[model samples]
Target chain A: MLNIKDLKVSIEGKSILKGINLEVKPGEVHAIMGPNGSGKSTLSSVIAGREEYEVEDGSINFNNEDLLSLDPEERAHRGIFLSFQYPIEIPGVSVTNFIKTAINESRKAQGLDAMPASKMLKKMREKMRLLEMDQNFLSRSLNEGFSGGEKKRNEIFQMAMLEPKLAILDETDSGLDIDALRIVANGVNKLRTPENATIVITHYQRLLDYIVPDFVHVLYNGKIVKSGGKDLALELEDKGYDWVKKEADNLV
Target chain B: MEDLKEKLLSSFIAFESTLNGQAKSPIHKVRTKAIEVFEEKGFPTKRNEEWKYTNLKPILKHDYKLLSHPESEIEFKDVKRYFLHDTDTYKIVFVDGVFSSWMSRTTHDGYDICTFASAIEKYTHIVNKYFNKAASQEDSLTALNTAFAREGAFINVPDNTIVEKPIEVVFFSTNSDTEMMTMPRNLVVVGKNSQAQIIERHQSLHGNNVLTNVVTEIFAEESSHVSYYKVQNDEYTASLIDNTYVDQKEKSNCTVDTFSLGGKFTRNNLNFNLTGEHCECHLDGITIIEDDQLVDHHTRIDHKVPNCQSNELYKGIYDDKAKGVFNGMVMVHPDAQKTNAFQQNNNILLTDTASIDTKPQLEIYADDVKCSHGCTVGQLDDDALFYMRSRGIAEKEAKAMLMYAFSNDALKNVRIASLRSKLNLVFAKKLGVDLDFGL
Candidate 1:
């Protein structure tokens, strides 16, 4: 459902992602594991159409449509959702209202009528229940004064609300405790279907155990050097990214 | 420099002859002294410290005829949109400085909500006591309004009574002449242990060269609570100078909010005096101007007695070369021990050419007082803007939503429901969005 061919990306004249290729079919879960500054997050941001990055030479195709030419909101309307590592705090805008606007705007861009309020509320309630969130959480300002675990949980809640075709969770388990990690992984697992996909980006292999991935790729120095099945994550966790880095260096 | 002053000085006799029977009243004596003060000080120049940022030279060059009475009639349907139509209110409306009896809804059931022109003769003693008592005699603009003060609203809430409906005082200037000036003087006296709310607005029908100098004096007796709101959304050719003075007695609470949305040039002089102990005062203002409009707000709060508290907050958003100025001061007297006062001013410039000058001053003579003041001028937060846009909201809508959130704090404490909702709509309209929230 998504394809990236030799993606060469730079930011402010400094190359970050150099000649990276990746392809994902429908219903396949992929895990991109890397150490710090390996361009894992940058790849996700570029796919989500962040304006700061300059695509020096690359092409990104989503459902056979050129994704680079669209703005961030337009890409979002095409079912590209990025769960941020650090969710921003927007004061004075309630969580419910923010989600409502996002949903309606995306629908309007696709020539669809707005979702009925009753149906929206019902879906929101069910999703919040799945995430173990309180009823009052929907009324509070979007991410303002929210705890770390709550922010991560809220990101998953938004993922569920948007129901994107391809979701990218960038370090979703960074600041979460074990319980919050389990809740978030379980929520993601429940939403997986035969027609949707997820790209789990993490530094460690802790999140992959709950939401198992069909493919695991090791990103080193802005290039994916190793690709294997689920056992690759366990092998990398046992041995470290240093082995993979040395292998990549030898190949270079 | 002396041309406008000479014209005003020469026209005083002719204006006095119009008030035939009431020429020898106490108000006439006050008017005679006020005109003398205006003559001495004349109009303030840019050289003056208080008038350094605001220039009145361009407005003074026009030959503006001082309108004393109503010359044309205005239909209720034409101006009903300005009122708070959703709720019931005691409305005292004026057309060209004359009280529109057909358009006004005054009451005498519990307290007085009528015109000062009638109250000056009926409640002569009360009128004489608080007519110009709270206004500053030293300021030339207040003196100018006092010199030509003839018609405005007069509200008096009796002791231990709570006014059910809010009082709305609106002044609408019609485009009858090319250039016209009007002076409206308002007096509100809330008796002991009473509560009241007042909303004041000045608007013009058409874009004419109209200048308004209005003065309002409010007296809050012991334990009384009062809320006053001023809405200035006139046309581009309209200019206004508003002077409001408030006095709070022991245990009284008073709040004044000024919303300046549109105008060519507007100046507000708001002052509060806390004479008795344990009183609370709040001064809040929000200004949004575009084009070549200019809005200046000058406020002063005096904590004369011990254990009194005051809070002042003013926010402004300027765009398209508009200029805004804010000067707020909090003074604590030597005898006013254990006083608490806070003042803050925040501004956002939407364009590179738009600018804001803010000054917050605190003078505390009491050793045991807590006084603080802060001011800021900057653009919108880039991080916040990016964050909102990343969530599928367009850039323009996101910016508008963030601005609406930024202005929410200043309007949080508005006491009148209808007025608060009306201001919410106004803010939404100014931000160019149909907001789905209510105040």
Candidate 2:
């Protein structure tokens, strides 16, 4: 459902994603493992149409549409979702209100009417149950004073509600505890379908244990140097990123 | 002496002279003083200290035909539209500058609701005591308002009597093309241990280059509770200068909220004096200006006695070359020990050309007081906006979402639902932003 060819991106004229080439068909779970500043997050933001990253040379095709040509909101309406590394704290906007607006906007883009209030509430309650989120969480302001674990779980809740075709989890496991990681993984696992795809970007191999990836890619120095089955995640976890960098140097 | 010289000054030397003929014996003393102040410091030029940010060159170019009485009759339907919904309160309507006894309700047997003219004749001492006490001739706008003071409503709640409904005073300026000026003098006295809520609404119809100068004084006695809500919504060509003052006695509670959604070159001076022990006051204002509109708010809160508390918060959102200014001051007197005063002014500039000048000042003479003031002027939070946009909300909706959230802190303080909803609608429409969760 997603194709990225030689994605060369830069921010402020500094090279970030040097040459990223990746492909993920429907129902595939791909995991990208890299150390900090290895361009893992930059790749996710680029595919989700964050304006900060300037595409020096490359093309991204999502569902036969030019992903790079769309605005961030337009990308979202076209079934592309990005779970931010750091959730934003929007004060005075209730979680329910925010989620409802998001859902309605996406639906309207697809020429569909907004979900009725009763159905929307029911759907939200069901998603909250799937994520094990407290009912009071819906009434509070979005991410304001929320715990790290709660924020991650809320992101998963929103992901479930939107049901995007391609979901990009950008460091979703960065701040999660063991229980939160399990809840987040379980929620993602439940929403999987043969027509959808997910790209899990993380440094640790522990998250791969819950949502097992069909493929794993190691990113180093702004390039994907190695690609393999899910076992590569375990190898990287055991050897660390330094081993990968040394091997790439030896190969070059 | 300035005071003596003011008495000798003509109350009607300017373009409009009929005001001097209508000034009663009780109000003449102050009227003369106001004229002297106006002459000494004519309309403020750009060089004046207080009028530095705001330019009044447009008003000086025109000659205003002074209006002292109601020129045309206003129907009850029009007055009803200005009344607060779901409240059975007395309605006093003022057209041009004269009170409409025919349109006002006279069944208020429990409350002392009378016009300024009738009150001046019946309660001469009360009218003489409070009438120009709130606004002084030191201010050019205040002087201009006083030099042509005319008929307005006087509301006095008896001692220990709690008014269940809110008293509304509606001021309408209708159909005058030439430069016109109308001064509305309102005095609200909440007796010792009484409680009441008052709403003052100013609306204009069918005129360009018209001016409305209003002065409102609220005397809140010991342990009395009063909430004053002012809505300044009028024609884009109309200019308004409103001076509101509140004097809180021992243990009294007072709140004044000014919502400036629509106007052209509007300036508001709001002052809260916590004069007695353990008094509390809250002052909040929100102004949404766009399309070359200019709005200014100068607010001061004085803590005089020990254990008094005051909180002042004002926010402005401007777009499309609109200019906004907010100057807030919190003064804690030497004797006002343990005073807790907080002041905050926040502004959001939507367009690059839109501007806001905000200054929050806190003067603490008492060492034991806790006082802090802060001001922030910036665009919407980029991270918050991006987050909303990433969720499929359009750029405009995302901006509106954050803007409304920014204003929610001030709006939540309003306890009245009807007033809150109306204010929310006005804000949304003025900002050109729609609210998904409509009130």
Candidate 3:
């Protein structure tokens, strides 16, 4: 559903993602693993239409529409979601109210009426239960004084509510405990469908134990140097990223 | 004196000449001294340290009608929406500095909830003891208000008497002959163990320019409680210089909140004097102005006795070419040991042209006291804005959300739900958003 052809991106004339080529069809999970400063997040932000990244050359086409031409909210309305690695805190805005506003705005952009209060409440309650969130958590300020686990869980909760076609989980497993990781992966697995796709960007293979990906691509030095099946994750986890770096260096 | 100052000084003299027969009245001495102070100090200029950021030349250049002329009457229905109509309140409504007996609901039976004129005539003892006592004699604006303190709200809750209803003091400037000015002087004396809530507002019902120079003195006696709320939302032709002072006694608590949402020019001088032990003072304000509006909040809290605490937080959002100023001064006396005072001012400048000047002054004398003050002025967080927009909220809606959240922290202490919802609506309207956050 989403295609990228030789996507060369940079920020402030500094090269970040150098000539990237990737494509993903429906009902597929792609894992993009890289060490620090390997252009993993730059790729996700560029695809989600964060205006700071300048595309030197290439095109991002989603569902036959130019994704780069649309604004962030427009991209979101067209079923593209990016779960931020570090969700910003909005003090005095409650979690439930934030989600309610997000859902209503997306609906309004699609020329639909606002969801009824009762229906919205039911859906929220159901999703909160799926995420194992407490009922009292709905009234707290969005991400204000929340723990690391709670922030990631809230991001997943938003993804579940929006039901995006292309959802990018950027570093979702970085700050989670073992139990939180399992719960987050379990929630993602339950929401998967034959017509939707997800891109899980992680450094370790622990998350792959639950929501296993269909394809694993090793991203290094602003380029994807290797691509393999899910077993490659375990192999990289065993041999470490240093070995991959050496192999890529030898190729250059 | 400058032109406007000389005009005001002579105007006061002419008005004072008519009260010759009643010179022996109890308020005569106070009025005489107040006029002298006004003459000696004149009007504050930009040279003064406190008035450096706020210039009064433009707003004071108007030739105001201190004395009223015959004008059309205001209907109850036309002005009813301005009141907190959901609940019954003791309202002392004024139309261009004149007490409207028909529009007011006052009582002198159990408690003294009446006009300042009647209070000075009937309850001279209470008025003589508390009126102008807590306020400054050095401030020319306060002295000016005292000199013209013929109309205002006079609320007196006796010792151990908790007022059943909140008091509403409203000053409305309607269609006048020329540019009109009104001075509202309020004196609230909550006796020992007493409690009362008051909401003060100055509104202009017409497009004509109206300058309201108001002064309010509150006396919270031993162990008493009082909450004062100032709602300054009016036409762009209105300007206000509000001076409020509070004197707290042992074990007393006082809170003053000023919500400045609209006006052409506004300057708020809030001073809290904690003279007794175990006193608590809370000063919070929220200012949201667009266009060429200007609002300045200058607060001073004096911790004179031991074991006292004070908290002050003021937040603002300036859009367009609007300007804002916040000066929070906290002082701890030499003998006031174990005192705690905290002051914070946060502002968001929406556009590059919008500006804010914030300063926090902390003068700590006691060695063991704890005092801290901070100030911040910046634009809304880009990361937060992006996060909201990526969730399908448009750019305007997202900016509104972040701005509202940034300013709503100061509204956490608002006890009035009806007023809070109205404020939320005003915020939504000002921010150009379709959602009402009161829900």
TM-score per candidate for chain A alone = 0.99, 0.98, 0.98
- TM-score per prediction, in order, is 0.96, 0.95, 0.98
lDDT of 3 at B54: 97
Model 1 interface DockQ: 0.50
Q: What do the candidate models score in CA lDDT, each in turn?
A: 0.90, 0.83, 0.88
Instruction: Write candidate 3's Cα lDDT for B185-256 as tens digits.
Output: 898999999999999988888888888899999999999989888998888999999999999999999999
Candidate 3 lDDT, A1-252, residue by residue in tens? 999988899999999988788898989999999888999999998887788889999898999999999999999999999988998898878898888888988998899998888898999999989999988889999999999999999999999999999999999998999999999999999999999999999888889899899999999999999999999899999998998899999999
Model 1 pairs whose backbones collide: none
A32-149 per-residue lDDT for model 2 (tens digits): 9988899998999888777888999988999888888898899999988899999999888899999999999999998999899899999999999999989999999999999988
| DockQ of all models, two decimals each | 0.50, 0.74, 0.74
Model 2, residue pairs in steric clash: none
Worst 10 residues of 3 chain B by lDDT: B430-439
Shares of reference contacts reproduced by the candidates, in order, are 0.47, 0.80, 0.76
State the TM-score for model 2: 0.95
| Chain B TM-score (each prediction, in order) | 0.98, 0.91, 0.97
Model number with the top TM-score: 3
Provide the DockQ value for model 2: 0.74
Worst 10 residues of 1 chain A by lDDT: A100-109
Tens digit of lDDT per residue, candidate 1, span A20-59?
Answer: 8999988999999999999999999899878889999989
Top DockQ hit: 3
| TM-score between model 3 and native | 0.98
